[model samples]
Every structure is written in C-alpha cells, then in structure tokens.
Target: MPVLSLAPRRSGFGTELLTQTVPYQLRGTTTLTFKPGGLQCTIELPAKELLQ
Candidate 1:
C-alpha cells in the first residue's frame, strides 16, 4: 500500500485553493483508475490490497 498527500496554494489576492488527500492501496496488479472533476479527482485502488 502507498499513501498520497496534497497541499493547497494560497493567493495574495485573497483567493484560496481547495485541496484534499486520498489514500489508496496497491495489490499485485499494476493499474490505477481515476476520475477527474472540477478541481477534484477520485481514485480507485486494487482489490487485493483492500483485503489486507
């Protein structure tokens, strides 16, 4: 299994950025699936690691 971290950037003009951290597990397979949205993304991990 692996961990991921995300950081948000701040603007001097009073604007803020949105950020999030998502954790995923890696199994014996080697494929990563993700969906992208407006300023956000969703990721799916393998099955084997989920059982661990």
Candidate 2:
C-alpha cells in the first residue's frame, strides 16, 4: 500500500503547487453524496483506490 498526502510542494520562483502523486479530480469528475447516516462518493478511478 502507498501513502497519500495533500501538501503543496515548492516550485520555481517559490510558488506552491500540488504534487501529482495521485489524481485528485479523478478524470475531472469528483462526486460526493451525503445521506442521513452515511455518505457515498463516486469517482472514475484507476486500478488503485486512493483513500486516507
């Protein structure tokens, strides 16, 4: 298993940018469904499901 994080990295000119270690938008479609007791999410993903 691999570890996932959301920290920005320093780029040229001292600018901060998100690392592309994992796909955040998930094919540009990130969906989240919330219910009374639980929640549901839908994202077009790859072979590995990245979760915290």
Candidate 3:
C-alpha cells in the first residue's frame, strides 16, 4: 500500500501540544480474508491498545 498524500497543520493549542507524546492506536478491526483471487485486508489498531 502507498500513501497518496499528507497535509500537516499547526493546531495553535499552545505548550501542551509540544509537551505530549501521543499514542498511536487503531480504532477499528483489521481483517484479513483469503479468497480465490487474493487475500483481502483492512488495517487498523485494536481497541485494547488504545489505552492512554
């Protein structure tokens, strides 16, 4: 898979933004199924790992 594009912008929320290290987590299920043609998949983080 390839990333098409990314656009970053400042939130202007001040110092708190600079001091925090945000955890990366998945919000949905990542599924992989086998088929005759190929394997289909959906990538995402699991809810159990989202604890902050």
Index of the highest-lDDT prediction? 3
Q: Which ten contiguous residues of candidate 1 have the minimum total lDDT?
A: 13-22
Clashing residue pairs in candidate 2 are: none
TM-score for each of the candidates: 0.26, 0.31, 0.30
Q: Write the per-residue lDDT of candidate 3 for residues 3-49, one digit (tens) a residue.
A: 32432243345322332322222345444454555545545555566
Q: What tens digits encode model 1's per-residue C-alpha lDDT throughout 1-52? A: 3333432343332121111222322422222222232223334555766677
- Candidate 1 regions exceeding 4 Å error are 1-37
TM-score of 3: 0.30
Inter-residue clash pairs, candidate 1 = none
Q: In candidate 2, what are the lDDT values of residues 1-52, reduced to their tens digit?
A: 4333432243443121112322454423434454454435454556454352
Residue 21 CA displacement from its true place in model 3, Å: 17
Model 3 segments more than 4 A misplaced: 1-24, 43-52
RMSD of each: 12.8, 12.7, 12.3
Candidate 1 RMSD to the correct structure: 12.8
Candidate 2's displacement at residue 32, Å, is 0.5
